[model samples]
Target chain A: MSLAASQAAFQAWLQQADDAGIAPTLADPRGLSVYQNNYRVSLMACLSEAFPHTLAWLGAEAFEGAAARHVDAHPPRSFTLDAYPQGFVETLRAIW
Target chain B: MPSPHFGPHFGLGLRKPHYADFLGGDVAVDFVPVDFVPVDFVPVDFVEVISENFMVPGGRPRDILRRVRADYPVALHGVSLSVGSASGLDADYLRALRALVDDVEPAFVSDHLCWTRLGAFQSHDLLPLPYTAEALALVCAHVDAAQMALGRQMLIENPSSYVSFAEDEMTEWEFLGELVARTGCGLLLDVNNIHVSAHNHSFDPAAYLAAIPFDAVRQIHLAGHTARTIEGREMLIDTHDQPVPDPVWRLFAEAITRAPHAWTMIERDDNIPELAELLAELDIARDIAHQAAADHQVPA
Candidate 1:
């Protein structure tokens, strides 16, 4: 595939991975799995970084899972990973 | 102005895990460098530093930026500026950044040399850019524009990348050197990032530090990275989760030898420990930075 076409396909696969935009017709869905994992981990990483207290408050498994979900729902649109997540205390209360 | 250069001081990346610890006056961190919102907007500690995380306005985030700036030493770091892009500058982003900078009046400003926007679409991640001539011009122009907007010099940092571009024209060392020479901006040197990039791209860590114009370096960043050997090629992803590794410490020591008193910070975005633990690491950094300065200085 051309670079532009590949980029477009990749974008479609990425921005709407959850949606039914693209179907899985490759050798394996490992790349998509890795993408989702990285996305989840990155968001989780940012939340945990910004809110170490929350990690202590929620514990590792619960906090990581909760943060992973929260970030998936409300991912940062900006480019900088330094923009740590907020409103987690409330998010925790809302979910947990 | 601000300290004008980085110094051996202790600070904390304001985290929610220690919110009650801080609120109840249990943990005693000196400078609290806060995240985007939640931790920043509400009435938390007073001694806070604001990265570009708090740049975007409105909602709880912007409100927190104002609230935190009212009391603490707000330092702005822009991760989205994409300083190393060959495409062009994001004038709108710069204007928004200018507005935010004016509002916060931070202690210092900073951003990474990685690109986020390509052509028109901006990525949410700090995607790596080619270390080339086109990249250099785009970055210098963006930095110059950032300085113009904020009316003060900002700190540009090196990024850790998993991939390198094949169409590069110049080197990161030369690019950063020329950037400091042309822009008069400060360098937020991340020793861990240097280590990560060095391992990923087979370069002498000492040579990288020796290449930087130390005087232009204003702040330093130390963080933890996870190693992944991709396709038999070693790659260290700058995942700031755990403790600062040993080789990164070595690189940081070398970099500080060049710039003795740059504002030093440790970025831990995940699996954070208590304020006491983080502060302990910061204390260790201070000692090492001091030792580096003392050991490198010539008896004149």
Candidate 2:
């Protein structure tokens, strides 16, 4: 794959767990899990940090469910994590 | 553009947990603990702040950075430059960073060599790039554009990556050296990153260190990483959540010997401890630098 195609595939795999898309270009398929874990954990942490009060109100289990759903649906567009929290209000409303 | 060579300096990343300590003199903020008292100034040469955090128009983030700038020389480190992107540089991002650079008059401005944004999808994580000639040329062009926009030399840091592409035509060190040669940008050698990538990819850390262009190295980052097993194979993740391990410290000692005058700092983003605790870690860097200075002298 070209650099652009490989990068796009890697981004898709990271955001969507579409491992099949990136597995071909990967030097080691096992390391793909590490990147996936990093993407999910960092995004979850971003949401948890952004909505402390909402997390408190919704409780950990429910808040995590919502955050995970948001993460699955919304592939972050902003380069900064600070801008990621802006969409969580809609997620909270849609779920709760 | 001038060099980012700011004499032998040691510092720490200005994290949220220690905001009170950085903003000393009885300046009470809502986030600070009520029992927190004003302490003496932190004994360090400089402090680095994440550029994206303070890229806003007006807020407490900007206020905190402004106040911190008054106390110590600040280094504007960014994560969103995405220089390795094949598409091009982001004009808005560069403009905001240039504004921050103008306001801070930072000791050095730096970002990673990896791309974080691709097209409309921003990964927010440092994604690896295949070290091919095409990617190298693209990165060099972006670095040149960034330096031109900022009107100062910029430093590019090596990334700790988990994956390497099969099509890579060069090593990360060679790519970085060529980047410096082509664009005249300095380097921020994160010793921990070299250790992590070396361990993950089964490369000799010493070899990578030896291949580095030490004269272009203006700053160094020391961070802790976590070790984990993936598919029953041990891998090191650049988690930045623990104290500087022994091996990373050893590598740092070797790095300081080669690039003695580079600015050194420790990064702890998660599981952040007390200011004094990190201060102790910074002291470790000081000791290493002191010993390296005695052991090997870089001519002025």
Candidate 3:
């Protein structure tokens, strides 16, 4: 695969855990799990930070569940992670 | 105003919890939000801010940054440069950053060597790049483009990575050395990142430090990391949530011994403690750098 394709495959795996994006191309895909974890954990941390008051109200378990759902629904499309929280309140509204 | 040249300065990442300590007035002594504190309260040579935070139209954050810059030399560190992207550098992002640089006149502008964006999707996390000749050329071109846009040379920081690609050509250090040679950019050597990447990839941390272009290094980042067991194997993550661990401190001693002139700072994003705690951590860094300088007979 080309460089762009390689990165796209990596991004695909990171966002969707679709190893088929790289299962054929990669020699060892064991580390992709780490990247996936980093992606989710970072976005989750962003949500937890951006909505601290909400987290305090919902508690860690509920807040993390909502954050994971939001993360799965929205793969950050902005250059800054600060923008990722723009529509997060709607996620909470929809869930609650 | 005198130009801000990078010296062997000790500093910390300006987090929200410590804003009062940084911008001093008659604020509360505890971690409660306050209007301000004393200007010279934190006691550091410089302060580093996330460039994207102030990369906005006039706001309270910009005002606060300006106030802080009046007291300390500010360093603009970015996360979304994505210089390693195969697509190219984002023009709009560069323009926004250049505006901030023009406003701040910071001590330095630095971003990670890894890519965080591709096409419309911005990962917001430092992702690894294949150490291939093609990637090296692309990164050089992007760095050149970024420097031209900013009207100054930017410092490229080494990122901690969990994956090593199959199409790798040279080592990460070799890629960085070549990048510096091609783009005339300086280096921000994150010692904690080196330790994390070294353990995750099973490479010798000393070897990585030795291969670094010490003369080109302008800053050093000391941060904490977390250890997690993935698939029954241990892996280190650059979480930056806690204090700088001892192993990273040892490697930093060696790193400072080599790159004595680099401005060093500690970065703590999540679970940020009080300003005094970070200042005390900065003291440890000061001690290490002093010992290293004294041992090497280099000016501290």
Top DockQ prediction, candidate number: 2
Give the range of the ten consecutive residues with the poorest summed lDDT in model 1 chain B.
B36-45
Cα lDDT tens digits for candidate 2, B153-232 = 99999999998887789999999999999999999999999999999999999999999999888899999999999989
Instruction: Give candidate 3 misplaced runs (Cα > 4 Å).
Output: A23-28, A52-65, A92-96, B1-6, B25-39
- Candidate 2 to native Cα RMSD, angstroms: 1.6
Q: Tens-digit lDDT track for model 1 on B225-249? A: 8876555555677778989888888
User: Which regions of candidate 1 are displaced past 4 Å?
Assistant: A1-96, B1-7, B19-52, B58-72, B296-300
> What is candidate 3's lDDT per residue for B1-300, written digit by digit as tens?
112463489988988787777776433355346544355556898999999888886977788888888888899999998999987889999999999999999989999989888898888888888898999999999999999999997999999988787778898999999999888999999999999988888889989988888888889999999988877778898889989999999999998888777889999988897777888999999999999888889866
TM-score of every prediction relative to native: 0.71, 0.96, 0.92
| CAPRI rating of model 3 | medium
Over A12-95, each residue of candidate 2 has an lDDT whose tens digit, in order, gives: 788878877688776888888888888888899999998899889889999999999999989888868899888888988898
lDDT (C-alpha, whole model) for all candidates? 0.66, 0.88, 0.87
Span of 10 residues, lowest total lDDT, candidate 3 chain B: B25-34
Q: Return the TM-score for candidate 3, rounded to 2 decimals.
A: 0.92
What's the CA error at residue B2 for candidate 3, in Å?
17
